[model samples]
Target: MIMPQQSSKNSGLWQQATLLPIALVAIEILVINGGMILDMTTSGTSDATRVLLMDSPHWFLLTGLVLGASEILAYRFLVKRFAKRPVTELGATGCIKETALGILVGSVLVSLPMLILWARGFWRFNSFAINSGILKGIGIGLIACVFEELLMRGVFLRLLEQKWGAPGALVVTSLVFGAIHLSNPGVTWLGALTIGVEAGFLLGTAYLWKRRLWFPIGLHFGWNAMQAAFWGGNVSGTGKQSGLLDGTLHGPTWLTGGSVGIEGSLLTAVIGLLAAGVIWKLTPREAPEMAPHEAKTPTDEVPDTGETPAITASEPGRQTRRD
Candidate 1:
């Protein structure tokens, strides 16, 4: 008849750490609008002026880089306080294998619907053209992964970990990811719920398996970039200005993803399930290590791993936040 209490160290002050990328996106878009001023300041009407102002490619890459830096800032200044891992565990090399596995895992996940639709003869292919080319499309995909994984797994999930524990963290963070995509041109409830659970399970599984940001990040990037840029199609809800397989979406809403985007298709659902299964298998049976006062596993008990920030860490937690 004992109630569980979260460790003081497991309680965090790292709120809003996960929204850095979105914030950066907003700022970047605003800056793009500001380019009109840059245009007027320079020569009034010319190709160069147009290039500087109306270029989405340059702006897209720039925004990705800026957002990435902001994400790093959040990690060092805020998110670290909520982690249950050490500095070494968060290193780029720490989860290299896991990241690679995550990419493969996501590809397999998207394949389920691919096979079914392919069998039904509903999947189609098309040609595309873009100034960014294949490399940019691919690079952009990888960038998307970094932005998403950093926010969800790297920052937000850990916040929940500090409170309700790992499973709770998974559910909350996963739903948020899916819910955020609701605005994609024509989103549907079935599609959103399917993606919410499927993506949540897969990404959460990767967090458990890799124990760092790299894996989930790479997976996110690979899936979307490949789906849109290389293969050519609508991503979640957005039609990417892509390279390679640039084509129009055709077929029924059930097969193609319709106006709501590719993630809405049953094909995506099937693939997502497969990927989730693979990652689940790869993930170890070990529960996420939390503080002692936080909760105890049936196994051996240890002191606060010191992974998260202290609830009263106004002083000390600030140090960890900056660390």
Candidate 2:
């Protein structure tokens, strides 16, 4: 029923959609596995020594640094080669301020739910202490938050937006993000769904708000580090050996969020969605004018400002010359 040219066009479109994401993921996996192998080799043949090294906060910090640098280089290479755009998402300008704001927002969102649960007598703190666990938590959070934001927002969401527009891209990315966590220990269907909806929109809107990766990365790191290391709660479904504050929840799984931490709570969902809405409202409707000194590619008719174009429901497939 289809003409050869039309069928070929469809096939090309499909390949275009699938290729970059697949390649990026593959590169990431290879980097991670290679790092693991390197760590094992350096730690020597004894299982005990390897385990000890792996658990050390210093080691985690070292690994995070290595992995972070590697990922950034890989991301920059891919974006430059395939997307033919400047790597402005990882721009250093105002990064500290944006990241700090994100950390504050994330801490507040997590705190509100815990405060409510405590007020209602559903939760209680057992103890407070500071330990190396906090450092380890920071290391883990840095690596994870950076890696995920790069892969999800930097790569997947950006590419999808090019094809499906912002709204459709957000929805698709959110679902995929949630689905990816189904394999995490202790995650339920409900838990994964909550993550998809709350985190997806929250992170996506953060990118839309500033058109940079720092805010979302800081937000993610703050949430996970606070929940697991500071608050003494499970993260996703996995429990750490220790946290700064030892706490217990005595309530329904729905209210307590069970093993998935506060991320699974209804209160968190409500608050996260509210925050996302506020961010969406605050997002600029149009890209700001670029400074005259800003870098421009030879192929660009207009300077690439790295800002997301104004999204409209009616033009889901509209193409723009800028990133």
Query: Any runs in candidate 2 off by more than 4 Å, and if so which?
Result: 1-45, 287-323
Candidate 2 has its poorest 10 consecutive residues by lDDT at: 288-297
Top candidate by lDDT: 2
lDDT against true structure, model 2 = 0.75
Candidate 1: Cα lDDT at 50? 76
By summed lDDT, the worst window of 10 consecutive residues in model 1 runs over: 6-15
TM-score of 2: 0.79
lDDT score of residue 236 within candidate 2: 72
Question: Residue-wise lDDT of candidate 1 within 1-323, one digit each (tens)?
Answer: 33333334324323344344455455445544656676767665787757753555555566556555655555554434444334442575746676676677566556556556656667655555554656555546645666667667766786566567777888888888888878776667776766687676677767767566667766776676667566665676665556676555568887677765667876676666676677668777665654333445655455666786444446743643422
Q: Cα RMSDs of all predictions?
A: 10.7, 10.8
Q: Clashing residue pairs in candidate 1, if any? A: 7-294, 109-271, 109-272, 109-275, 113-267, 127-246, 128-246
**In angstroms, how far off is 149's CA in candidate 2?**
0.8
